[model samples]
Target: MSGATGTGTTMREAFVATAGHLLDEDPRVAVVLAAISADVFADAARRHPDRVIDVGIREQLLVGVAGGMALTGMRPIAHTYAPFLVERPFEQVKLDLGHQGVGAVLVSVGASYDWAAGGRTHHAPGDVALLDTLPGWTVHVPGHPDEVVDLLRRAARTDDRVYLRLTNDGNARAHPVGAGFQVLRTGRRAVVVAVGPVLDRVLAATARLDVTVLYASTVRPFDAVGLRAAVLAADRADVVLVEPYLAGTSTHAVAEALADVPHRVRALGVRRDVELRGYGEPADHDAAHGLDVAGIAARIHAFTRA
Candidate 1:
């Protein structure tokens, strides 16, 4: 619903829509989010106390508790800041949730430069690599708020463990739902796919380079078949998977999937170490390291020449 600023609906509204519809269908839909968006889930929780579990500032406890609730047959949707959700409780996440193979969904906000002034400490760019490595985990990186709702629906229907990488621009952006990448446009030279905030830049660069734009919302459980299809569709053109995380996009994941396709594959994400300058918003820091849209567009074009 949050369709990019003045385009459609707000992200908070989309979150509400997704949660509200799911709750209506299942009275057992217990919510376990944080105070970050308390008002968003409060109304639903107020109406159904037995369905909401608030664990403020305790990300590890929140996730562990949610896993326990799921084991006890209570459907819990735990929410928290992306950094806290994964970093604060890395062990709890790896052992309590991943190792045990918990079936609850982790709806994380502040994903990938969503935090402006919080600096590198607050930014969450490691989620993809961390979550993907955990056994039996499914990761979804929705391009917009609309896709957030769609992915949630798909998660609800599936039986595997899930995590939605979230980014709130303080505005709403729209995203589509599915298991993997979706090409928004076609090109003859190369295939350009975006993972996070750079989708906007990719759309703009469509005219600059003889390239096709693809949106990759589902990070893990990557559709190798889908990647192969994009390569084949592009006449075996070069394929690039883009991301803002520090090399989180799985080049190997795509490479293994499209091994037979004759094309060079490169993953575009933040480098492992840029020795960032003290502090600033996540976007500024990312921009300094060529993680912004302009940098992303340039990289895709370079691949075309190579």
Candidate 2:
């Protein structure tokens, strides 16, 4: 219900506002969460402690309880880290959430390796790529603040299973979450589909170059028309699909789907040969793997102009 922004509504403030809004609507919307999404979850509980049921650091039990709560007609928003949400209770996520087709709102903090300093065990970089292949799961990576707010509210109302990837990538701004893919930058230079927060990197990339940036919010339910238009628009330009996961499924799947598109498709992501290490920042880590703005810009320039 909180739609309009007043004067100084930052994304973080809007985030808590949405949570409070949901809690106000129903006091039974229990938040089952762990340590990762502690920030927003805690704030939500602080504002409406009666509605949130904290599960400490127990991600498995947290989700299991949430799934159980879902069975009883309560909306459960499970907040946890990406690695654990999809990794630990993966079976619960599949059976309790997926097979049952229950609606589970997963608010993941630093869902991707966007956590940077967390290292491998903590780095959930490949989670989205993995979720991309999973059936009955809606994977959403909101790049900007507005997209986050809109999608978070929508997800709250949705009665399906979804795992949200939230992060603090330096350029993640507040933008509306459009269903179809959008052309952040329209150019013939080369189509670099900015995956999620990577779109911000895409914008930063354009500061010194002439590259096209496509803001792709929904990774799953891959926007066929939007993606087709975004990709086909390239019209034989060397195009690359960049992500923060390994060079397998996420990239290959996209490449296969858009193979018919005239553009020469390429993928830029974690090499996977080595465990992804970071310099404690999303941009730096992505830059290290040639997945950041400049790196993607370089690839587009090399592939298109080469």
Candidate 3:
């Protein structure tokens, strides 16, 4: 099992370790599952049977139970694949937790096309966009296992509704987890905002270019102030957002942030126009969606030249 330190651990391992630690250290912490990562929690469940709940294949009930637990003053951590956790049980998430105004941490894996072999049934490129319709949610897309551990711990301690989107992909290095964007590189031409695991590819794509690169794990609460600051620091109010989920997911946020400043933005991410049916690997999906280093660089170069 991985520890809270998070070094050399997968994002899933970090989540399990952090959640287990929360259960051990906090009495209010409870874990609700829909059969995802159940075996990992066997020991924790044995120790705190009352708090660890597995609701079998019922995705709706999985969220309902967590909401019910939250109603009773318990903080619940709900787990499952992205499509099942966010898209399948959305109504439950909307009413049980959102409408009722209770808090629960929902952790999801198999981001976007991580399990490409599972096909469209397993993909969730619109999870963040769906969540955007709701109010008062803290959405985290961690690029590293360390960030996952950090964000999960932060979410558990609070009563806010949190979505910790973990993934099979990760960055080479972990940036400091903070409320706003962490500025990695600065330039005056344009601002390139890389969300989550796409940071590495974005850095590589823009290595020889003159652009400011900002890394964001926390996309919600959209960090308008930070984005504005970065944009204003640049010579041109041009922004390029590269997200891990649906393309243009955060474009509206960027527009709103740069409103009244006469800025331009180009958003890049998983395509929403057509469903990509074939996939050999995660990189294959990335290339198909123009999220690979070359794809990203080409788009950014064009935007900068324009």
Candidate 4:
């Protein structure tokens, strides 16, 4: 597959633009911005003032209001940074949306350390883990701007509770959408699963290794079936899961999926312990967390040999 690098559009721009289109096309579509990317939707807000609203930095009200709109039969799309969207308004997400059984499309940017210079307050390594606590949430971690557009459209069309995670990092190419993992390359010694924006780095990491690589954009409904099939195809019970968030986020699901088979698993992702007080760019944070290409390659090489 060809990797599309240096694309003019970014995931954030794609999401905001597509969301605006949804707002114009569908009357039921309502957007609640937390002043995070309010400017991105300024035109939409002006055109449909009642449908698109900026709650001005209040994360709690941002979610609560969306839930309220959903209750009134409007499909709400709430946008903000990951920390503000999921962490700050967690209770509102749990009670207003989850407990109340109302569905809203929650879109968040600045995944993990995407805004490394913004410090821990802006970092949200636990966003997905927090959402996992609630049941029936369709979580999507798109790796490209095109994928973001597609997933946002999909989420907007349904009333199901959805959380679309957006990040500054991305892969070279966009793959087809499905619940199962898409096999990008084949090998025999082991299988490596790359989640969302980690695909390009994972590919570079395992380039020389004799291992199968699978890419996944949607991880919440972990593709156990596809995972097992890929593992079996590689004829290697050894599996390595590379995620962008906290390590071992999908370890449980992988274990359950391969329960019947004899296998060894390794999980790689951002570290939960220790605070890296220094940050320059996303690459800087990735290197510190051993998520850079060299770091990932070193770990995967050692794991495959083991």
Q: Write model 3 residue lDDT over 87-163, tens digit each, in one string.
A: 99999999999999999999999999888899988989999999999999999999988899789989988999999
Candidate lDDT (C-alpha), each:
0.71, 0.67, 0.92, 0.89
Candidate number of the best lDDT: 3
TM-score of candidate 3 to 2 decimals: 0.97
User: Over the stretch 29-130, how does candidate 2's per-residue lDDT look in tens digits?
Assistant: 777766554675666677777567777778788888888888887888887667877777777777777777677887776555755777766677677766
Between candidates 2 and 3, name the one with more favorable TM-score.
3
Model 4: per-residue Cα lDDT over 104-136, one tens digit each: 999998999888889999999889988988998
TM-score per prediction, in order, is 0.88, 0.84, 0.97, 0.96
lDDT of 3 at 19: 88
List ranges where model 3 is wrong by over 4 Å: 1-7
Clashing pairs for predicted structure model 1, backbone only: 2-9, 2-172, 2-173, 4-172, 4-173, 116-281, 147-175
| Clash count for each candidate, listed in order shown | 7, 5, 0, 1
Regions of model 1 farther than 4 Å from truth: 1-8, 170-175, 235-237
- Give me candidate 1's TM-score against the actual structure: 0.88
**In model 4, which residue pairs have backbone atoms overlapping below 3 Å?**
4-172
Which candidate order results from sorting by lDDT in descending order? 3, 4, 1, 2
Clashes of 4: 1
